[model samples]
Target: MMKEISLEGKTALVTGGASGIGYAIASEMIDAGAEVVIVGRRADKLQEATEKLGDRCRWYQFDVTHVDEYDQLLNQVDEKSPVDILVNNAGINIKKDFFDFRAEEFDRIVETQAKAPFMLSQAVAERMKERKSGNIIFISSLATILGMHEIQAYTVCKSGVKGLARSLARDLGPYGIRVNSLNPGFVYTDMLEKTNLKTPERLKEIEEKTPLKGFTQAKDLGMAAVFLASDAARFITGIDLVVDGGISSSFLI
Candidate 1:
C-alpha cells in the first residue's frame, strides 16, 4: 500500500482491540506507519493479537468499564508515548427487549460504550490541547440510524457516542483536536457470530437489504478509521462516517 494517509510519526491507542473491529483498526494504523497500542480485557487475547501484529503493535489488558483504572492506564501509555490518535472503540451489547433489560445490564453497557469514551476523550483531549494536535475516533453503530430490535441499550449507547463526538469536536476544535464517529453496519466478526443475526436466514435478510449485498468487513472499517485519523481528514470533525453498505439509505416501505 502507498499509505497515502501516512501517520509515520504518530502513536495510537485503540480500546477493545484484541479482536473484531478493534484489531482491524490497529492493524490499519500500523500499516499507515503509526505505532499502535491495543487495549482489551483478556490478557491471552491481547498477547495473541500483539504477536500477530508484530513489533509496531503493543497490547494493554484493561477493561474500559473499570472507571477507577482510567488514570492509571492513561499514565502508563503516556509514559511510553503521548497518544496522537485515540480510538474509543470499546463496547458491549446485550440482546434483550427494553422491558426485559435489567438496570445493571444497561449500566454495564453504558459504562463501557458511553462513559468510558467520555473519560478517555477528556483525558486525551486535555493532553492533545497542550500539544495542539490529536485525533479521536469513536466506533458507533448503524442502529443509531435504524433502530434494531432487542438491543435497546446498545442502540442508546451508540447514539450517545455520536452525540459525544459532535460535542467534543465543538469543545476541542479550537485546541487543534478533531473528533469524529464512524458508524458501522453489520460486520462479520466473532462478535457477530454470537448475536441473533448469526443464523443463516437472518444473515440472508441483512444481505438482501444491504444495497452492497454483503456484510461489511473488519478491514473496511479499519480503512475508514485510518482516513479519519490521518491528515487527509484534518478539516473534518464532528461528523458521522457511516460505513453501512447503503443499509441506512434503504426503505423497505
Candidate 2:
C-alpha cells in the first residue's frame, strides 16, 4: 500500500499565482487539501484565478519586485492565516545579447527573481522558526545548467535561487523547515509561446532534444511542489528537483 500525500490544514502562499506556472502550483496545492493564497501584481488576473480555483483559494494583489512592501504583505496575510508554504515563483526574463545587457536591466531581473525571494524567505523563515516548521520552494530554471542564449540576467538570477535554496535548507533545517528548488524545462506556458516557441520548428527542435520528446506542462511542476510541501517529502531538503522531462539527462550524439 502506498501512503497518500496530503497538505490538509496547511496554508500556502504562492507568488505570481495569477497565471502560468504559479497558477498551476496554487491549483495543485489546493487540490491536495491546502488553503492557498495566490499573489500577483494584477488584480484582474488574481481575481480570475481565485474564481477558477474555487473557495479553497484566495488572492492578494502585490508586486513582488517592490521589495520594501514584503513585510507589509506578509503581515496582512499572516494576520489572516500563517503561511505554511512559500513558493517564490515570481520572476521576469528580458532576453538580450550578453554584451547589450544593461546594468539596469540586470538589476531589475535580480530584484525580482533573486533579491525578492531572499528577503521573503528570510521573513517567512523567522516566522516559521517561531513555530519550528515551514516549507520554502524556489522556482528556478533549467537554463542554469543548460545555458540558453540571450537570457544572461535570467540565468544568473535563477542560478542564485538554487544556491539560496541550498543555503536556506541548511540554515532552516534545524527549525523544521525545508528549502528546495524546482528547475522547469520548456514548459508550454504563455511566456514560452510568446518567446521561445514562436516557430513550430523551434519547438520541435527543443522537444526532440528532450529525452521525453515533449514539452513539460505547468501542472507537472505544480504536482512536484505539492509533493515537496506535503509530509511525503518530510525528509527531503536542500535539493534541486529538476522537473524538465529528462532534458537535463540527455545529450545529442
Candidate 3:
C-alpha cells in the first residue's frame, strides 16, 4: 500500500508559507487534500505563490511580529476547524553581538518566534477546545539546541518556543488539541542565501558535520510537517521533533 497522508476536510493555515520551508509544507498539505492558506508579510510574494499553488492555496498579508495586529490576523484567518491545523512557521532572526544587541532587535526576534506562535496556538486552541480537536505545530529551530553566538536573540526565542509547546501540550492534551515543535537544521533557504555561508566552502563545512552528509532540502521538512499534523502523530504531543539530520548528535562543534 502506498502510505497515504490524508487531511481531508481539514483547514491549515501556514505563516511564512510564501516560500522556503513554509511553502514546502503548504504544498504538501494541498496534495494531502487539505485547504491551505499561505500567510506572509509581502503581498507580492504571497500572490506569486498563490498563483502557482492554484486553487488549493490562498494568500494573506500580515506581519507575524506585529503585536497589535495578531488578534486581528487570527480573526481574519477564520479557519473552519474545530480542527484548525496551524503551522506557526513565520519567524525572523536578529543576529548581533551581545554588546551590540538593542531592545528593539531583541523584541523583534522574540515577538515573531515566541510570542506570535503562542498567541496563534492559543487562538486556534480556543476554537479547538470548543470542538475538542485540533493540531498546533510550531516550527522551532536547531539553533535553540545550541548556544550559538551572535544570534543570541534568535536562539533564545526558539528555545522559549519549544518550552511553550511542551507546556501547552500538557494543558491542551485533556482537550484533545495536540501541540508539538519541529526544529530544522541548516536548510539552504533564502535566509541561508542571504547569509555569508552560501559559499561552496560553507556547504562543504555543513556536510562534514551533518551526519546525513548534506544540508536538508525544504521538502524534507515538508514531509515532517505533514506527518506531524496528520493522524499518524495522534499519540504524540509535547515533543520536539528535531529534523536536523543528526547534526546535534555529534561533537561537531
lDDT measured at residue 195 in model 3 versus the true structure, 0 to 100: 47
Model 2, runs deviating above 4 Å? 1-4
From the highest TM-score down, the ranking of the candidates is 2, 1, 3
Query: Tens digit of lDDT per residue, candidate 1, span 1-253?
Result: 3455898989999999989999999999999999999998899999999999999998888988777787888889888898999999888788977788899998888888889999888877878899999999999888888867788888888999899899989999999999999988889887667765767998889889899898889999999999999988989999999998898999940
Tens digit of lDDT per residue, candidate 3, span 1-253? 1244688778899999999999999988888888898888999999999998889777779887665676666666674433369999998876667999999888877778888888877766877888888889998887787766577888888888889989999999999889999888889988766642648887788889998788888888888888888888888999999888899887984
Estimate TM-scores for all models. 0.96, 0.96, 0.93
Local distance difference test, candidate 3: 0.83
RMSD, one per candidate, in order = 1.5, 1.4, 2.0
List the pairs of residues colliding in candidate 1.
none
Q: What is the lDDT of every predicted structure here?
A: 0.89, 0.90, 0.83
Better-scoring candidate (lDDT), 1 or 2? 2
Error of 2 at 212 (Å): 1.5
lDDT of 2 by residue, 43-119 (tens): 99999999999999988899887767878988988887899999999988887789998999899988998999999
